[model samples]
Target: MSSRRTLIRGGHVLTIDPSIPDLPVGDVLIEGNVIQAVGPNLQVADAEVVDAKGMVVCPGFVDTHRHTWQTQLRTVASDYTLSDYGLNIRLGYSSFYEPQDAFLGNYAGALEALNAGVTTIVDHCHILNSPEHADEALRGLREAGGRAVWCYGLFPNPKHHPFRFDDFDPSWRLDDARRIRKGALASDDGPVYMGLAPAEVEKPAFEAVAEEVRFGREIGAKVISCHVAMGGHSVHVRPSVTTNLGRALLLGPDILLVHGNSLSRHELGMVRDHGAAISATPEIEVQMGMGRPILGAALRAGAKIGLGVDIVSNIGGDMFHPMRSALVEERGADNDVLFKNDQIPRRLEFRCRDVLRVATMGGAEAIGLDSKIGSLTPGKKADVICVRRTSFNTMGAWDPEATLVHYATPNDVDSVWVDGRAIKRNGALLGVQQPSIVEQVWASRERLERQYREINIDQLRSTKGYQRENYGN
Candidate 1:
């Protein structure tokens, strides 16, 4: 038997690997699922050739955190704050989700990511209303044909019972998580790996949180993610989640903390020393009043940092928004200090390339897949994307990294490949009935909207206030 081969020819290639120099005009040869070679004018026989002229070929973006289950609720919470999201999407809209809704959302969301050149994601799905919901969500991810760490959410759905701030059972969720680990997600080498998204650290008891982390490790989960140090909650809650976890000696490299906007410098250092990473979703963090992004702090503390979309319900799924948002926010913060000191800034400290790295290599490192899919280095998996440099939005690109970070959009993505397979070619997704998926998602959205309006919004708001007072949500 012969191996399959694809030769992507003649493009400006940005291999994120530092050892490999960027190619002004280059070819990436893929044999089977791995990158066979990357250089100029690679000669190969009996291979399918893809013309990459007028394209910017690079490693596909890695989104370290996303609530992909909210695909059907796009723009439903565009004006929502962190509290509003909890009350409306989490408590209100989530009550009407059926198993098919979970499947459709994940499936459509993963496709949305692929369309935007995000080849891999850490799906922080917190919509597990039942074990069947878990199964369907995973099924949707698999069917979408993209790479992901489907972090099985342990957060209890409000639909299952009245929203509880403190008292809730994790025993059943843990059992189901075990079942998922041993069943479909037994192997880490698969396109989709198993991860754990435990309940929010502040809402749950310390002992229970520690137990969840231990159970994730015991089951050999690829990553254990948690929401920590977000917004006003961090200011009100004493002894940050990092401090608590560190005191108990539970912090490890596998832990990926999301939205640490209020994490102090000391806490950031602690995260670095303990080998954990942070995922910053800049747009949502800023818009939802989660405070300024922690990118600047995390960088100063030398913590591993990645960029994420967070939720499509309020923002777009593409990595462009987060990349640009992070870059500008950090630069603006630097300028503010200069202005405060009665001095004009001479140079920008945060570079466009830095945020681009956060979207690709940094994200892969955050999710612990840097060795496999972060770069276009030979021997790594072939997860790559080609953007149309000739497009009006991206024309006359001088610095490839800057062009990508500042100007590129999902529509400019010409092609995408994952595991050497062409998931998107000629600006269209492959092997999926996109129209049918969109129709189903729209139907789900309509049904959810009708059901949500029937719920007592005033009562939900009161409950939100109660939770805020008690659990510091």
Candidate 2:
């Protein structure tokens, strides 16, 4: 028996492990923060019993591409194009945000994510205009009590913002990186892991940006994330620039490239050969009118491909829709086959469960956390979520994999455990008062909107290169 274990019995266990096929009726023993054992009819006297009867016990979902701050400003700039949104909403809204707004927005955002069955999120926060705001934003995320990489990013600019590799030496973004790095290592309570996100390739001093990437190693920044191939934004440089820098700086594992839509074959191969990762956000990409999916190539290139909901402001932020859309879009893109021919019968490309792998294991791999999380194996972190199959939509659903991809929503999630801690229990939040967060978020949004009305940001954007010339988008 495990020393301090919790045994979950009497249900189907889909560990989502490709190595060991699914378990129809099995028992799982979670010892401390690690999954100690898995088998049938496991007996334990002291461990609390979880009656997972008629439920699916799988790994918690990971959203590797989300703008946590923008979630507070949902549907604000929907009328604008990608470029228009960036110049108006992204840059415009960011400039107006004080530290308090960031703190409140991130706090609200993290709660929303946890409630939606996402155990981990790449909080791609690019609104950090100063050191104080960065710390405030990070504090809110850490207090929210979910696994997140507080991805550091620069504030957006309408015109081309050349990053001098030299000037980044002591800027707020780099300082935030240094401070978060120190805090993570020095914190006695626990680590609040932070990652670097220069927003886009064109935002920073390229050389300094490269220096920051190198500095990540020195400062223990485990991950470096960038908005790659997100073609819809007004300020979005050609996807080629993103892939080029990624090739230059993202040398190996732990480098996360978000929105790999325009990634070419050679670039995909480079990413694979370098052992990098690709984060595909189907919901936001499809919503923003980015061309058909590029995940297939990234997946085939042997790079670690993960799933994310992307910008919550543009679309609903639940991980469920992204997973659902991925399943449907991938099938539609390939016609259920990579290349259909008169001779070959749809060569069985990208299955439903395979996409689930991207959301779970692929995400972990992308962020370099696979050993601790991502799977329900012995000696791994007990980051688990149980989806009740008896829910109205999923009643009597026997196929566990199919049920998850098709019917399961965040509300149907029975429980969510992060590092053996039940932050979400019985379909409700345990530690935080979610209602208060919700109220505050709404208040903040209303306040921001009122403030937006005060600032003529649309008039401001008119000064920059807000042209209609699409970059082959």
Candidate 3:
């Protein structure tokens, strides 16, 4: 290990690991990228001491799925439905992206998440319009210095795109995946890993889907993420693609299904039995009329559940919003079912801590990073965060987990560390030029917005673009 050592002391620690009990005043010793010890007190001679008094020390939050390149378009789709998103983002703005735009967006998004104490992210990058786009996105992640899985995308290019694709071959996607797996991400033990986000079932036939899965497996992808059973009615964006793929996809433990808003109990059970996990973006799913959030349903069906902020284009990027949304949505849904039978719910089946677990451990498990992160274990990676409870909204932090999940916001995050490196200290990103990042994102957003207007936004607002593709032949 390097000579660098950090000692975080004098804080209320919530380990989140069952093997260790919560400590009212604990100390954590970190050496290099891994934690050395966690206890009531630790005496270390050659270490930089960080006083954590009046703070809640815990594991950093993990987001299983985020279209991070869409960070610059934050809140642009505040009122957009699933169909509207497909029309505007998938087919419009996404078509105009240059590699630099992908870099700035991904880099800015990574920094944004890090500033908010999110140490790990699964960047579901479907805007890989070119080979250079893939390189730029991975570079952005590495430059931003966060743990991530760059899920290489295979979404088909739209015919109406202004970008020249006469020479673009779909086969290049496979070659790029191979290159990334063998070259850019040869070792799976780094802070960033390689994963695959295959094209939706419609674009890729059953054989293609099988090929993608086999390719991912052959390359030992850390995770194969898919958006399944989401939205009201759209084959291209949110239809029950998983139901169509069924067991033929050969999903294993490496697969992580996102959304699943419309997934049946049978599908959920199949995922659970196959050791696959589900990442539910409760806020976006609820906002887009994608039926109820599947937190309770997935949990009851014995599937591992995780939380994600699906899109910054519509909802906030903080994990708190999704956690809170999941909790209340499930309780409200339960109450509705009880009232239909003329009965009242005696109590909520899920607690605040449950959602917090979904944000931390469940999320880590979703991306297969739980053993190294998600909890402040002695042997785990030092992906830790400290939330100052002195803020007006989080004062009197009698309950650590409750205050974190319900009351705390990104503003309360005082310090964040990933792999023993301080990324955010004293509520600001360390060594990051925020103004430059902002400037780049703003420029990219302006260009994307100007280009998107050419695609006729009014038409997108008036109708669903990809809904017709749902007609199964």
| TM-score against truth, every candidate | 0.96, 0.88, 0.93
Who wins the lDDT comparison? 1
Specify the poorest-scoring 10-residue window by lDDT in model 1.
159-168
Q: Write the per-residue lDDT of candidate 3 for residues 1-473, one digit (tens) a residue.
A: 45689999988898888899989899988899899989998989999999998799999899998999888898788999776787778867888889998898899889888888888998888889889999998999999998998899887655444333344467788899899999999998969999998876544456777788788899988988887776454435333456544557586788888888777898888888878888999888888887788889999999887899988888767788888888899889889999999999888888887888889988998788888999989989999999999989999868888888889999999999999899988888889887877888888899888877777556444433343333333
Worst 10 residues of 2 by lDDT: 157-166
lDDT, model 3, position 221: 89
Report the lDDT tens digits of candidate 2 across residue range 295-356. 87788778888898877677766777888888788777776453454344345476777877
lDDT of each: 0.88, 0.72, 0.83
**Regions of candidate 2 where Cα sits further than 4 Å from its true position:** 1-3, 77-80, 156-170, 184-191, 203-205, 231-239, 246-250, 336-348, 465-473
Model 1 accuracy (lDDT, Cα): 0.88
Q: How would you order the candidates by TM-score, starting with the best?
A: 1, 3, 2
Candidate 2 vs 3: which has more lDDT: 3
Kindly indicate the candidate among 1 and 2 with the higher lDDT.
Answer: 1
Tell me the deviation in Å of residue 200 in model 2: 1.8
- List candidate 1 segments past 4 Å from native: 160-170, 463-473
Q: Which residue pairs in candidate 3 collide?
A: none
